[model samples]
Target: MEIDQAGKTNGQQPLFPTPSSTPPPPPPPPQISLSLKRLLTIVNCLLLCLGNAGGPIIVRIYFLHGGHRQWLSAWLETAGWPLLLFPLSLSFLYRRRSNPSAPAVLITPRLILASAFIGLLTGVDDYLYAYGLDFLPVSTSAVLIATQLAFTALFAYFIVRQRFTPYSINAVALLTVGAAILAMHASSDRPAGVSVGGYWKGFVLTLGAAALYGLVLPLVELTYSKAGQPVTYTLVMEMQLVIGFFATAFSTVGMIINKDFQALTREAANFGLGETKYYLVLSFAAILWQCFFLGAVGVISCVNTLLAGILIAVFIPMVEVLAVVFLHENFSIEKGMALVLCLWGLASYSYGEYREAKEKKEQIASPQVQTSAV
Candidate 1:
């Protein structure tokens, strides 16, 4: 009843068809392209955008509460906050040093010099950003800052020999559209906004800073990729921080030189150290954030690390809303819209990255399986 054994019946080859199709070659695995990867890189840049926006938002809150020019000066003015980062970073460095695989020799002067350069770059980047805030809205500044993604891609293409894809171009278009929307909203209105303390000169300077910061990543990679182990990377960063702190302090020397030392001290006491203490707390928070950032980058790819900034942006508006409801502050709808755009952009960016990653994982696993089967 099953079929004639080893004999043709009605010209049939076999009852199971003799695996004629060869399982259709497993349907040929899914294909990915260079363009898709470029999209992911853009998504990472979106994360950086959110981070850029968050800074101004923080500064704005301070400004609303009668804190003037604090973001730049607060860290140095407080002893506790600056020291916090040093210890945390040092702890990380020590852990790396203690690893059995780490070399026995101490870090060299050449490494320190390289690290200092990075620090200087970082310090200048901050100053430039602060300068831009003097002329632009928090929302607009965030959009403008998104340009760094473009810069990052440009650097990657030219320096790292990374290729760009069509997806990257599309991602750039989305970011640009969103940024333009945000920028239009920012420039359209001004109510109780801080007056520009300077002129076009300030704007130009800030733009320069953004460009320089955009350059820092490549520079760091170029210098340290040769000798930097993961632990040594931390040491490099620490060196940069040390140098940046001093450099910034030197620039602000005018604050010390021009102001009456005795009168300023008296005024500081009258205002009470409570406000200064607030700066100290924020500075510590900044340091903690930096640690978190570095850890995130270390554990995940740089793309993921950058995209995580959207989480920060998402939180900013929520915090602002809570302040308005509980603390009784007036709210601006414009700020709300800007936040919404940033969140949406972030979501799109993240989805694109996830899809790309999932595709890559499948692609890698499939080859191995095929080879084993063969």
Candidate 2:
């Protein structure tokens, strides 16, 4: 019998029972194996590292290959903001088609304001980073950017109430010391065509960029917490989309004010690698940066802000090595020592996390054991 007819025949009973009368549905199966998920996370993290380290290297290469337009390069790098639309659009399409009744992302005025502020900060940070890469060798710039770990820790503690264990403290101190040693050495061994003053200028700008971004990461975490929803990939992408939109807008304004758009034709014509290659490099750089952004956000959502910062810092050594091989930049003994210190700091943090997790597991098991004994 049809559901409606059965209900009518049964008088007060409905053929299609109310949802409350129905048995709950079984939970959905896991989308992937645990091991596969972990492997994918590892791959994503490595890609994040590559994109973070490689973007600057590409900019450095551009300059080396007669691309003197620093502002233009920076603006082009911000193009990744638009590329974010691809993923965001697909996510929206999937959700709308598959689960149209799902709650839409809450877009409060406060969220909009926060995202706009972050976008403005990101634009400034990008320009400063580009300025640093333009003036300093890739190796020096990488070491300097590693200082962001210390700044991030500081911000996370104050902003997000993140704890600072002995190991974390030690890690920060070692990273700070390593960066200082590298900066001290930067002055004397300036790269060809780079002046002592230029090196210092770049160092200051890079340091500023690092500090700004340090604050930005924690702020992002705080925003997510305030969003009043369970964290999901779609939500994360939504936040990134908003931030990228305003960031790109800010950069576009800068390009216009500085007339970089007008000079694009001349820069392209004079580019050492020709117009096609120049555009290709910029395009690749933008895409890689989007990967870096997505990876960082994914890590933050899955882990915590501190681990994201540590992962970036840990990859500094690899970036330095890549710089040496690809850019032919010098790798000094001091840099070698700095690399060791950074790795040591990373290991310390990892050990601390391991111990803490083990202790938590034991604590949870102890109560069960006691109950079973009784």
User: Residues 1-374, candidate 2, lDDT per residue (tens digit)?
Assistant: 43454454434566566556868875552355557656656766876787887887778878888787667666655568767667667867776787776445535677788878887788888888888888888877877788888788889989888888888788878877877777777666577888878878988998898898898889888887787756666667777767777777878887888888898888889888899998888888887777777777677766678878887887777777888899887888877888888889888988998889899999999999999999
lDDT computed for candidate 2: 0.78
Q: Tens digit of lDDT per residue, candidate 1, span 104-204?
A: 33446776677556655665566566556555544445556655655655665566554444444455555545455555555443324545444344456
Per-model TM-score versus the true fold: 0.60, 0.85
- The deviation in Å at residue 258 for candidate 1 is 5.7
> Over the full model, what C-alpha lDDT does candidate 1 score relative to the true structure?
0.49
TM-score for candidate 2:
0.85
Residue clash pairs of candidate 2: none
Task: Please give the CA lDDT of all the candidate structures.
Answer: 0.49, 0.78
Write down the worst ten-residue block by lDDT for model 1: 72-81
**Deviating ranges (above 4 Å) for candidate 2:** 1-44, 103-109
